[model samples]
Target: MVTYRSAGVDIDKANEFVKFIKEKVKKEFNLEEFGGFASGFPIKGYKKPILFSTTDGVGTKLKVAQAVGVHNTVGIDLVAMNVNDLITTGADPFIFLDYIATGKLDLEVMKQVMEGIIKGCREGEVILAGGETAEMPGFYPEGVYDLAGFCVGLCEEDEVITGKEIKPGDLLLGLPSSGFHSNGYSLIRKVLEMNNVSYEDYVEELGKKVWEVLLVPTRIYVKEIKKLKKNVKIKGIAHITGGGIPENLIRILPEGTKAVVYKKNIPQNPVFSWIQRLGNVEEREMFRTFNMGVGMIVILDKEEFDKARELIPESFYLGEILAGRKEVEIL
Candidate 1:
């Protein structure tokens, strides 16, 4: 008669891991009267408050983490992806929850992961209110884990920046990404493995190991953009992830307006070019798959372009909004 622990699902270890995380997770909070339920925020000034929420996972990047046996950074990637999406709608992320499922319980690995999560919450100015961890023996291979995050944000109803205000002649500002970000890794892994490329290999252009470039943590733009909100007239914010520029930017465009991205102005990270060449991937496919160096974009009036630039120093003036169908044009 085999028991659950014998079957590779250790309930005792899972419980012990949870007990360890409780203290570390509390470091993400400063409130003395922190409620035991979902997180709560003080809403005093906003006449009409609107809640913003988003849930996201790190995608196939998990494969990279598994390949490298590095787990902490992916946890930060999970939080950044979800909280960054929350801020796109001009929401201030206040609380975050995470879900971790693994084939077996590993306290050491879970502790490292939770540390990254706590770091992300601190950077995004959010509280890690609650989360779940599950150990399923047959669901995943040993040493493999999956992570997802849920975030809730707050904004005044009247102040939500839903692109309704985006108009023709609005300037498009592109924020630089760290690397491939959290998308297109399925193709990346396939291309690398098929070509017998190891993450340890060094590319001259990147001046580092392949996995180092691939693992560069996703940028958290919430803190920077939130500062700009005080004075800038930001019409909309787009978090460019899986769909790349054209698909992601179009989501925030108003019905009558379209976004025109100047391909020349779009910065290309060397890692992307290396991937394209390695796999003989097409240019269009490259644009569709990777962030291509522009991780987040801000749409605002042309007059505010200078101020926007001042706020985000490394950003590029990608293009502008135009009177057209709700589509995006790459000129």
Candidate 2:
């Protein structure tokens, strides 16, 4: 008789993985959000409390982690992807759930992934409420896995940063990215393959192995943005991800205002130039496809520019808001 395990699904192994995760969660996460069919988190004491949530996957950046055999940080990327999205809406991250699917259950590999999640939760100051792990043998190749994260953030109705007030003459302040934050890996991989570059190959300009550079997990702006909210009047916040600054910044832009990002003003990260040179990709495509150097953008009135600078002294003056249609011009 055929069994589920024979068909590339392992129920017992999956159960074991769940058991392990339960122990980890109990130890590392805030127990107040623990022990519920649906994780229970209280949202009391906020005036007009609202729930902000986002679900996101790591995309092709997972492939880079697999290529490098570095599984720990992609889980952090998973959490960052969702938590960062929540903060853009001016929400304080409260809880996170993760989904893991793979061909066969590899405890060590998944442990590495979960370790990163714990670290990410700590950094973002969120709880690991609950999650699911699936062993789909036929669906995924052996040694390959994928992760998706769901996050819930709490914010007051009035404080929700919808970017509706963004207008001409506002300043575009850019926060620096550590590296490519878990996006645009499909194009990045293609360039590497076409150029015969392996993860281990050292690029002089980048000063690291190809995969080492690519697997740098996404940065979680939860704590920083939360702090900024208390001290600064954040008109809009854009967590630049898959679409880069042009596509992302435009999302928060008001109908009458546009974003002007000066190319020279951008603190260009080296990996972008390396990839552009290798792929012969145009400047526009580069900005459209990758975050380049800018990670998160904070938009505020020109009058509040110094206030923002006072808070984030190292923030770069990317460009200025302009009177135009709702789009971005990366000059």
Candidate 3:
């Protein structure tokens, strides 16, 4: 008879790993029905609520973590990847689940990963409802794993912040990024290799090791955006990820409106300038790939500028919306 273990898949080991997580799930999550095929999340009281969800991975940030021997923070990166997108629609994320695939199951490493996930969940105010762990011996290298997460949120139909309300006179307010919030790492890795710089090398500009700079977990903007929604007439929000400010901003822009982001106006981290010169990367490529500094873009109505300014007093004046076609331009 054919067997599963011979095919490099460990079913029993996966079960044992889940066994370890279940006890903690009950104690920490109050989840009695933990190990079922699907998880149950209890949410209620949505009068005209619409559900929003997103699935995302941390990209090559995981490789940076592997090269640095740090796994904890990437779990936060994983959670941030999904929940940040959910918040773009002005929805409150209620629950999230993770998928972890590995060549081998290292319980210690897995535990550390879970630690960051729990921490991220607390930051986003979302529960870690359930997750899956798979061990495929040949698929991934030993001591390496990949993580992705799915997040679901709820918001009233009328409360959605779609950029349809954006107009020519609107201003774009940008929130500062902690670092390269979990995107462009593949190119970053390429840049590193081209420069022959090791992850352990300390760069004076960053005042830290290379891996530490690259592995900084993505910021979860769920709480901040929700707070701003209460005080400001936020026409739309763009979670700057892989596409950076230019691509992500356009996602929410209404027709006949163009967003012009001024490069000099953004508060940039020194590391970006360092990398740009080192990699010979152009400005448009920098804006398209890395966040360059702005992690989240908030489009505020001209009338609500004062109230919004009061809220994010230090927000960088990225640019203004202008009457044009549905597109984004860097000024």
- For all predicted structures, in order, the TM-scores are 0.94, 0.95, 0.94
Q: What would the per-residue lDDT of candidate 3 be over residues 1-331, giving only the tens digit for each residue?
A: 6788777776777777787778766777676887788876655787898999989988888887777678889889888989888998989998899999899888788887888887788888887889989887888998899998999999988899888888899998888888889888888889989999999999988799888788788888877888898887778889999888878998898878899888888786898988898899998898899898898999987787767767777776789999998888887
Model 3 residue 112 distance off true place after TM-score fit, in angstroms: 1.3
Worst 10 residues of 2 by lDDT: 29-38
User: What digit string (tens of lDDT, one per residue) describes model 1 on residues 19-99?
Assistant: 666667655486444335555567666778898899999998988877887777888898899988999988899889999
TM-score for candidate 3: 0.94
lDDT score for candidate 2 against the true structure: 0.86
lDDT of 2 by residue, 10-86 (tens): 78877777777788888786374444567776677898899888999999888888877899898889888889888
Cα shift from native, residue 11, model 3 (Å) = 5.2
Candidate 1, poorest ten consecutive residues by summed lDDT:
31-40
Residue pairs in collision within model 1: none
| Candidate achieving the largest TM-score | 2
User: Which has the better TM-score: candidate 1, or candidate 2?
Assistant: 2
- The CA lDDT of each predicted structure is 0.86, 0.86, 0.85
What's the residue-level lDDT of 41 in candidate 1? Answer: 61
- Residue 237 error for model 3, in Å? 0.7
